[model samples]
Target: MVNTRDLRVIAVLISLLFTAFFVLIILFRGEIDTAATATVESYGLVAIFLGVFLLELLPQYISPHLLVINAIFLGFHIVPIILVSILGHIFASLLGFHLGKVYGFRLVEKLYSDKTVSKISSGMDRYGRWIVLLSAFLPFPYIPVIFGSLDLTWKNFWIFGIIPRAISFALLGFGLSFLTF
Candidate 1:
């Protein structure tokens, strides 16, 4: 087994590869086919990779549309979406955790504003894990902004984030499955 840092590197590299592939397709989309789409689905870590890699650029949040993109557009099986969403949530949470850790609460506070960070901190202190679950279901940009504020361990974050994310994607699967062949 490798270290966590190495694993993060690998995940990031794999994600970049997928992103490069997507860029290529979009650049010349007339040639794309279901096989290309299927290949992306097979990556299994695309969503997590994308979220972790783009965490800063993407406003550091989770959303329902993200799940739908993972479930329907990414072309993965229902199970994969659930699994990836959990892992993605973990990866995303970890990204935010380290940001908080590296930057420290004060620096992070400066990034937002004293009052806003205080409000978010207060919310996390008050709401705790249920807010994480709500963020998973509500489809707003809560994970990075809120869960990141809590600064919990990756283990706890995954437990709270994954269960609800998987449930949401599973529901998406059951709902979408009905409309397909």
Candidate 2:
């Protein structure tokens, strides 16, 4: 069964992954920026839509915010970018949550024993709201399957996960509007 220690270790590992990703972005900013520019030039807003959708939908350990930031810095209009981002995030959230709802428990059970699953279920029962909300707002994994396997209600997930995430993207989009360079 997964214990508190295991959870802590997982947290640390995720933190390290985000840190590594940021470091890589800083180190390869020029290359990444160039590629992003090329992508936007080649595909236009479709690129933004797909980038945000895929990044948020998949377990790629990359943030969709990067694409948004790039679009802003590339001189795209903020309103359309934010609108597309919200759509992408919302669609991804819906699919991810449904996937979790449908397949999360079975997949998790295959990986972990029944006892562990039971314990996890109970823990989720106790703290699923906080977990969902935290994952939504924080830079955590943001995997909706965990929310689904844990049995978070759709209402709770919508309120905590979808709304907060959309707001975050909108806020980031607007906030980046102020950047001069």
Candidate 3:
């Protein structure tokens, strides 16, 4: 008999598994041009949106950088790409926030040692919104989870988190666009 807690965990795990399967398909199928760009172009913004969404939701599995580069490679105009990517990231962060709200510190504990999670939690408490803002540029994959775990207000999270992340992805996308190869 699965209790509610067990059911919730099962749901999260199943979602993760599906995300993993999609990541594997993206990783192993072929070259970026053949597999990734083709898929992005074929599906247009929806594909890009979903790819970036998973990139945030399962940061350990997908490379956010690679997703942006692939989108650029497919000749997605910079503004739309940035907008779609930011929306996806914000949506994923909101999901993580709710998950954190429901499961609390256990989510962080599962990903990191108790000591590490405590330290991070402490830093978040002390630093608050600044930490959330800086995380966008710092490659701190677990920032959303941390913020969610702390039950940071939605207003603060959206304002602090989304802008910096959008700027970061824009810089990255435009920078990558300049490379000859």
lDDT of 2 by residue, 105-145 (tens): 77655444465456546656777687567666777656665
* lDDT (Cα, 0-100) at 56 in candidate 1: 27
TM agreement with the true structure for every prediction = 0.53, 0.69, 0.67
Q: Write the per-residue lDDT of candidate 1 for residues 24-55, one digit (tens) a residue.
A: 64455544545556665566467545653354
> What stretches of model 1 exceed 4 Å from their correct place?
1-48, 51-58, 61-67, 70-76, 110-119, 144-159
Task: Mark the 10 consecutive residues where model 1 has the least summed lDDT.
Answer: 56-65
Tens-digit lDDT track of model 3 for 61-164: 33565666656655567777778887887788788778877888777667545554666677787997777787778855445776777878878887888667
TM-score of 1: 0.53
Q: Estimate candidate 3's alpha-carbon lDDT, on a 0 to 1 scale.
A: 0.69
Give model 3's TM-score versus the native structure.
0.67
Sort all candidates by lDDT, best to worst.
Answer: 2, 3, 1
lDDT of 1 at 65: 37
lDDT score at residue 147, model 1, on the 0-100 scale: 52
